[model samples]
Target: MSIISMGTHLQLLIHPSRSPIPHRGSLLQVADHGVRGHRHVRAHIMAARKAIEGVSDELNAVASQNMDFAPARRRVRTAFLPVQQQLNHVLFKMAVPEIQMEERYEKSSRGVEIFWKSWRPGQGEPMKAALFFCHGYGDTCTFFFEGIAKIIAAAGYGVFAMDYPCFGLSEGLHGYIHSFDEMVDHVIEQYARIRGMEEVRGLPHFLLGQSMGGAVALKVNLKQPREWDGVVLVAPMCKIAEDVTPPALVLKALAIISNILPEAKLFPQKDLAELAFRIPQKRKMTAFNAISYSDQMRLRTAVELIKATHDIESQLEKVSSPLLILHGAADKVTDPQVSRFLYDKACSKDKTLKLYEESYHSILEGEPDDRILEVINDIILWLDSHSTLK
Candidate 1:
């Protein structure tokens, strides 16, 4: 029999002398398989064993209880997901510092920083009409347009897409919430201020706002007003049904809680990362693997995205610009009702609602590239027809 010390390096004895031990597991054995990430847990156990074994193994009853802290760990994870989503929403969209997207640049304003890409046609000198793109929450606009730039540019429009503040090549900060009025009045004004070069100020301008940007475009095109050829909104998140509580609420709640407890973890993305906005018609490609990791889509701190959502029912009457609301009938993100609502309610004398039976939330960049191209051509044709008519 051997005696072991309690506080110093573990003492090893040749024989066991205990009649009964509370923590009766073997000194070198482990229960349950390893966690996916902490593959080195066994090593950690072995390393700590040299120091902790000195205490009577009975004490391990208390230590083991502390080891399997499932409830506590769960609470910790629950809190972390939201905050992480916010930071990553900006980081994942930008240059990523570690992995570079095709085209990247930084722009700053109002103590805010953003990243953008001004993709011109590779074949021609330049385009007369400009396609301004605004991305949704937690998405990089450049990535959304990745391989489709040539198709869009070929249609005689220079594509200028931007990652929202705190995303992509933009700066590092929590997501910034923008009111519809602010997006149109302030954000677009920021674009106009820098865009007002004598040579290009008078060019045909068209705004393409997707999801959150759609709401922004609607507000901007209506109030501030732009003499653009037309406005195209794809799957704008104007009105989300009550059945679905968006992550935006999590972001907002985090903003409030984080103010009080700066270090408190806000885990909104846990659910979002698991969700995917798929079109049920034939199934299309989504940017994030929603099926496998639905929470990944919720990778953004949703407060800003949430704030961008507004019911423009009364405001729709104010928009005078020609509008195009393109929505996927089977989108898992924004509902077709939104498209129906916009079409039935918009007062634009020349409003068009094109519902693609096979398209999803990412109408332009989903599974079948050819179909998206067709939509683009249809847009150009409509724009040309309207231009000729006017």
Candidate 2:
């Protein structure tokens, strides 16, 4: 994906083979033709790159000492997001003319300004249902999900997503999770208002979660078992793979330290893009997710993630909503076996699971275009079948 400034606007271009719709001719052009726009975008990219490079040395120094420099990191991320978001693989150069999209920030009950987005079918198109998304840790719904939401909305469903407090464009410390449960409550509160909108008030609603967001969806279902009509999980993080988890003693120590320094960025870091994206090109594009949380895990955030997984594991049998679980069999970040475990333990009378043979954790955004479409089509099929159920 590359950004080209055309006159006053930035245009995004995607390689032919990477285009989500294979039938659409190669070279997705997203901006009006303008040499001036190209110069503007080039300059913007250069400036953002320089700013990021300036902070590299300081970030490395802080990392070596296992100290928190989140504020500095956040500033760089904020500075680079405008350019980065334009280069997102799924979004760059993609067009969804049939879908109408809107972005806004709403004041949550807790007084935090929550950033959210919605995609609905164009005027005169009858709504089918509503799909509320729970984005993964380190992810903002405004990036890859932007293209995804449009696809679903084009299929006649209303799609909604929000950035968790502190994550993405939302207000709060970047990558700092004070309490997992409180975060869940914030999601519930915000989604409830969207669900109540007159446009979708009486429609069936489903929850779709990827990675850590999968755990969020599960918790939401558990908290209000009868609220959602179904759930779609993509490589869910029900149990953090053992290899990725810290040693027992290390986890114990981290838990102890979290009580004192909940926001400290002391946990280990890993190249998650490598583990999650199977296609080399797609993996490389992950670098453009400017607002994603790529730093070391915060002390409390790590502990809370572990605890949330454990809690979900124990309550799997209680999951009664209709479920559609899609996982990459070769996923190493989150265990594919755990997705299997979820399939077996979920008490939903209607449940389905599809495992891609050599795919990685990010089936939707990291797989071949055909595979990504396959997963998406599967989700739509399942939702279509269940949308009529009371």
Candidate 3:
């Protein structure tokens, strides 16, 4: 998440002052009513900080451990699930009362229990199109996306998102990826069902991805070129930034070790939240994402990510879906140049790229409320323009 100066919209909701937690209803009231000229918003931020701090030590301890297996990671997630849901941020607390949300667990073709979610306009609202989400590495669709999906749904689109097997509420080794291609197949399978749903059938379908998930979306489009109408990429990992990638010798060593102990949590990694979020308050809030994979990269996961990016880089010309690529020019996690490369290489004649100057990797979640809304509005406008409803 990247930082930005607090805009008027955020000033109404967050203050640097420290205070005790306010009542949950009061916090919601302030958000719903757009209340200003009070300390309630400050109280809310301080309260959230307290809540996150209360659990940080425990979560950090768990993250520091050698959680090479699914059970260990699952245990930590289960233990902190309730705490995570209660933590608040500007995005999470934003009110979108006109949208309906649903969650369920389904058995995938590979027998993994997948956790999927949907956000749609209220029953009587007009339906326009469908947007399927692909979340970034170690991130869950259930966190910051709740507010984002609701905003999109309120704009007359059906928004669908899912936790990949082994991530979030999905059943599998937590934070483990045996094969990146198989994961993409699972996403394709689940989305195929959602596309066929009665509510969204026959509507334009778009794929939206962030960071590593950007790579996943591209792979999905490559595998089923005609299935999607367009693709939206946010700071996509077409190629990992050289600053984040390990030294070539270290990468080679990790690749060799992965074959022997694929799940070992030994690969070194920097604090991504620090690098990705520009806002100090927002970066601090990342601890509230209790289920995100924050430990050392698992040996196999690292190798698979490297291989996936390489594969996508070589096949960029095959991406034929209408494309809208958005990247933060200052993003350190994923190279913005690669997004430009993708824009130049994709075969789709209808493609666009918008680069936000001074923004960081987590553009939607970390940027100021004004900037965040700008990006969301940009996306909604693009969707409206491309949809049959327009």
Candidate 4:
């Protein structure tokens, strides 16, 4: 379970020594949130999308409520939810914060308000520690931070995450979505800047991405090939689930549409208010927090992200950074099989892959918190095992 630490920092929940803990009868395991996390994600998050603003609330509600609806021959969960993501080892819900990114980074960089918080280790210890995160599409750093930040912070890692360029309260053009190259390039430059920071300088620096964030981590690691200890991709969208429309088609559409209607959104609005009211888990979907807040801030854009992802297949071999790919087999979004493909193909010697069954694309957001923490713990354990930072 010891993770190598050379470049940035790495954190993962590794397999335990000897026999593993059993999950039967655990409230967290079978919690209402675990099973319904995606439905809620689609409904609650799809609810606040400004992209779907003009779309009728009725359609919005239908889309939100019916996101999981499948043809009669196949159940919604059975038909659309990719099998690779659905049957994985374990995927938990990640929820940390109801906040948004803002300021300086936005004005100078992308126009989105980006705020950062740092948590230091206990006194008496050196302060050369830092972990920076980049978020995925339609998401704010606060969204994932809501669930994972505390455990990571508590583990003595000073974590940093910024709202995506066009996300959250970051001041930027509404529909902006960065290319994988652009996004990761920004990450590498910032990483160097962070490494220069006195408190974070000497310590192991870890760069991480979950979901689309994982793709960012992968592409950045691919292009820059930082000698840092490790890079991690949780449900990295290296290739994508085979289900999406072909890249040629998507790109042609983007080319035709970007010029005329760049602001045109991808996801329309929906009824989270109704869906949240339906979740049996503690009932009422987080009382309308991040999902609701996010629903409001997101645009229907990510085509750029998708396009950037398609280009990476040619570039993955350039990545030299040590990597750990964590994927949920049951992810409804990114395919876990894609993760396997990367672990096998990436040109890194110190690479690792961990797969979780029953986890969703939003592995960090399921009802049971263990799935999320465990994955993070594995990352930390791996980093700790390989680091000389003490």
Candidates' C-alpha lDDT: 0.46, 0.71, 0.72, 0.48
Q: Candidate 4 local accuracy as lDDT?
A: 0.48
- Per-prediction RMSD in angstroms? 18.6, 13.6, 13.5, 15.1
Off by over 4 Å in 1: 1-107, 122-126, 174-186, 242-267, 270-301, 311-314, 387-390
Error of 4 at 71 (Å): 42
Q: What is the TM-score of each predicted model, taking all chains together?
A: 0.60, 0.78, 0.79, 0.65
The parts of candidate 3 lying over 4 Å away from their true place are: 1-51, 54-88, 241-254
Task: Flag the better candidate by lDDT, 1 or 4.
Answer: 4
- What TM-score does structure 3 among the candidates reach? 0.79
Rank the models by lDDT, top first. 3, 2, 4, 1
* lDDT of each residue in 1-390, candidate 3, tens digit only: 211111221100001001111112112112221212322121111112123466667665664443334456557666766665665666777777678889888899878888899999998998789999998777778778877899999999999999898777787766678799999999999999989888888889999998778888999999999889999988887865444444567567667766666665543333455557778787777665656665444557767877787788889999898999998888766668989989999999999999999988788888888888899999999999899633
Off by over 4 Å in 2: 1-91, 241-252
Q: Best-fitting candidate, measured by TM-score?
A: 3
Evaluate residue 246 in candidate 3 and report its C-alpha lDDT on the 0 to 100 scale. Answer: 49
Q: Name the candidate, 2 or 4, with the larger TM-score value.
A: 2
lDDT of 1 at 388: 48
Error of 2 at 56 (Å): 16
**Best by the lDDT measure:** 3
lDDT tens digits by residue: candidate 1, 1-390: 111212222121111000011122223333333332332112111112111232345432322332112233223223333433333221223231121123544444555445566655544355556667765554445433544444566555566776554433354322323233443554575557536755346667777777666776776676556556678887775664544433444445544643333311122121111112232221222222110111111112233333444445457666667888887776655677877877777767888888888565556644354566676677667655654443
Tell how far residue 259 is off in model 3, in angstroms.
2.2
